[model samples]
Structure formats: C-alpha cells, structure tokens
Target: MSHDNSAENPKNIDRANNAVSWDNSIRLFLQQAGSSSPTPGGGSVAAIVAALGASMTSMVGNLSQGDKFAAIHERIAEIIGRMNRLTGEYEQLLHADISSFNAYLEALKLPKNTEEEKTLRRAALHEAALHAIEVPLRLMESCRDGLAEAASIAEECNKNVISDLGIGVILFEAAAQSALLTVEINLASFKDEERKRSFEQKVSALTQEIGELKIRALEVTRKRIAGDMA
Candidate 1:
C-alpha cells in the first residue's frame, strides 16, 4: 500500500491544521488574518461580515417581538428564523471559502514532471479553481439573500432598534459587494466560457438586487429613526 504524498506530507498537515475557522474567537480570527498566512483571506472575511449582518438582523427581529408588535409578531418571528438560519449558513461558508482556496494551493503542488503528470495536474488545477470560484460566488449569493431579508426586517421590526437594522444593512451591503469582488477575482480562472458567462450574469443580477435592497432598507430605517427622534 502506497502512502498518499498529498495526505501524508508534513506541509499538508501544517496547512490543514493552520487554517483559521469559525470555531476560533474574533481575536484569533483577526490575528490569523493579520498574520503572513493567506488562507483566512478575503473570502473568509466576507463570509464573516455577512454572518454578522444576518445575526444582527435576527437580533433586531427578536428584540422587536412583543405586545408592542403584536399585530406583526408572527412575521417578525419568521424573519428571526430566516436571519438565524442565514447566519448559520454564512458561518459554514466562511470555513468552506477558506478550504476551497487552500485546495487550489494544494492543486498547484501536484507533480508535473512528465506528460501524464502535467495532464493530471492541469485537470486538478482546473477543478480546484472552479471550486474556488464557487465558494465566493455562493458567498455573494448568501449575502445578497441576507441583504434582502434584512431589508424586509425594516418594514415591521421594532422601531427602537431601527438603528441596529440600519447597521446590519450596511454590513450586509459591505459583505455582498466584497464577496462579489472576490467572485470577480476567481472568475478570471474559470475557463468554461458558457458556465462562466452564466455565472457572471447571475453576479450582475445579484449586485443590482443588493443595491436596491440596501437603498430601500436604509430609506425605511432612516425614516423611522427620524420619526422616533421628532
């Protein structure tokens, strides 16, 4: 039985162990991000920001529910559920994005000394790059969805925490835009013209939707804020 070099290599062990993830504290995550290591980079950070936004959306929704909001209590509860789920999903995606990019790095290390080796290496790299592209694209889609959900929260959530909703909107918009940028970076390596074109179209639509949702959420949030102030 042959030992798999990719699995048994000391370098591989180091990388697998070193990759930063959601289980780590914010302090640890930020420390890793600031370190020379590149695994916990843009894609992971984007997922984290988006998750925070979703969590905040859930926070506001849960806080707003009571006799004060009895008329729309159920709707607020539904939004709470959705935001909570999105927060969990985004947290998972944070680890996934880090793994995908690391897989690409591993693909780069495949033996390419001979014709057969070169062909295998090329195929592996192509597959890994596609997976890498997929991670950030999913991140964008998740953030876009979170933004839309957060926008809806402004409509019926507690007026007192309207500022929290507003903050969540900004964070969601930041995550969506940053995740989209990360997708654009990876898209360059996705060589399948047809699928790449399809993905790009989805990105365009997602960006437009994110923009509109942010506009509406902020407008509603500010109006309520002003009304409260006056």
Candidate 2:
C-alpha cells in the first residue's frame, strides 16, 4: 500500500496512497496533481482508471451470479477472482509508475559538472530510463489481461448492468493505449535497440489484443441489451 518513491528521496508514491478510501484517495490525488508538483501524474492515473474498470468487472461478475445464471456459476467465480487479482496488480502498478519516474528524476539530478560525473550520470540515466520503460510495459500487460477478462465476462453478466461492460471496454482500451504511449516515449529515449524492438513488439501485440477484446465485448453487450429488451 505504501512505498518510498525514489532511491534518493521519498517520492509521491507514499503521498498518493495514504488516503482512507479509494474514492477519497482519488479526490486527494487529483487535487495534488492539479498542483505544480508532478508526482501522481498520468501513469498513476492510467492505472487507477484501469483499476476502476477491473473492479467494475468484478462487481458485474459478483452480481451476475446465483440462480439467474447458474450455467456460468463456476465461470463467474473464476472471472471475479481474476478481476480481483488484476485490481490488486493495478493498485501496485499505480505506485510503480510514480516510483519509476522518481528514479529517473533522481538520475537526472546526478552531478554533471565533471567529465567523470557526466559519464556516471549518463550511465545512471540509461538505467533509470529502462526502469521507466519497464513500468509502463508491465502496465500494458496488466491492462491486456484485464481487458481480456472483461470481454469474457460481458456475455455472462446481468443485462441490467450490461452498460458497465461497455464502460469497462472503453476504460481498458484507454488504459492500454495510455500505457503504450508511455512505453513509446521511454522506448524512444532508451539506447538499447534490441530492447526497444522487444518493447515495440509488445506494444503491437497488446494493442491488437486489446482492440479485438474491446470490439468483441461491445458486440456481445449490444446483443445482450437487445435481447433483454425483446
């Protein structure tokens, strides 16, 4: 729940996660974010938003269980469990994003006055940049799994809550895309051509999978809503 953000200084990860409730924490985070301080920035927000989608998927799964959809009883349980796990992963990622960036920021502050200092700073920066790249990379993978689970649960959950599935699709799509953008930025900065290629491949794969799952969920959601009306 709490972590020191940077190796050198306490970063925003601790400051952001200290609130009493998720909703209150979001409110407090947003207020702090609106300031000049740049700790709980876009990466954290993306994970938080994706967490909302994952939590909603769990809600739908829990509510859709019982006699009404007994055929999917076991499946619902599994989906809810997956969503809970994804939710927890995203929670930790929210801090990881901030911590990674904080590490990069700390590297940037390294002394650059001497030739030796400059070389050391350069090496440290490349290391930190890789860390920065890695956080969003894992974030994309988490979003990838979260979106896939959302698609699977869409067809099984209650029609009354069908609309939340659509929202989940949108959030998952947004989360994946946002995380991809972050990775792309770091990929550009990172000096390892092979690692950049690997990251690029993941971005491509995650984008495709996230897209297909979102479309599949939307189609299923529409049919279910129409069937309910009929």
Worst 10 residues of 2 by lDDT: 1-10
TM-score of 1: 0.88
What ranges in model 2 sit over 4 Å off? 1-24, 113-116, 228-230
Tell me the TM-score of model 2: 0.84
For candidate 1, the per-residue lDDT at 169 reads 91
- Please tell me which predicted candidate would have the highest lDDT against the true structure: 1
**Tens-digit per-residue lDDT, 13-40, candidate 2:** 3443332234556568788667655556
Clashing pairs in 2: none
User: What is candidate 1's lDDT per residue for 1-230, written digit by digit as tens?
Assistant: 00123455554445545666578898988988787655476777888888889878888988986787898788787888888788788878877776765676677679989999999988887777677777777877877787787787687787878899989999989988888877787677567899899989988998898899999999999989889432
